[model samples]
Target: MPIIVNLDVLLAKRNIKSKELAKIINITEANLSILKSGKAKAIRFSTLEAICEALSCQPSDILEYVKEKE
Candidate 1:
C-alpha cells in the first residue's frame, strides 16, 4: 500500500504500550493491532483524532505516503 501506517513507531517513540493506547483511544487492542500491522482498510476520523490526541502527535506522525517504483 502506498499509504503506510506508522502507529507502532509513534507508540514506541512515546514509550506507550499498544494496550495503553487502545484504552486511551477507547478501542480494542485487537483493533489497534490491526491498524499497527497495516491491515485496516480504513480508519474513522474520530478514531484518528483520538489517536493523535492520545499520542500528542499530528496525523502525519502516524501516517505516511511512499510512492511505489513503477
Candidate 2:
C-alpha cells in the first residue's frame, strides 16, 4: 500500500500509549491496532478528526503517501 500510517510514531512522540489514545478517541484498541498497522481499508473523517484532536496533530502527521517503485 502506498498509503502509510504513522500513528504509532506520533503516539510515541507524544508519549501516549495506544490504549490511552483509543480511549481519548473513543475507539477500541483492536480498531486502533488495525489502523496503526496500516491494515485498515478506510477511516471515517470523524474518527480522523478525533484522532488528530487527541494527538494534537494534523492528518498528515498520521498518514503519508510514498510512491512505490515500479
Q: What does candidate 1's lDDT look like per residue over 1-70, in tens digits?
A: 9999999999899999999999999999999999999999999999999999999999999999999989
TM-score of each: 0.97, 0.98
**Candidate 1 TM-score versus the reference:** 0.97
The alpha-carbon lDDT assigned to residue 8 of candidate 1 equals 92
Q: What is the C-alpha lDDT profile of model 2 across 5-49, one tens digit per residue?
A: 999999999999999999999999999999999999999999999
Given candidate 2, what's the lDDT at residue 50?
A: 99
lDDT of 1 at 15: 98
- Candidate 2 colliding pairs, count: 0
Candidate 2, residue 9: Cα displacement in angstroms equals: 0.2
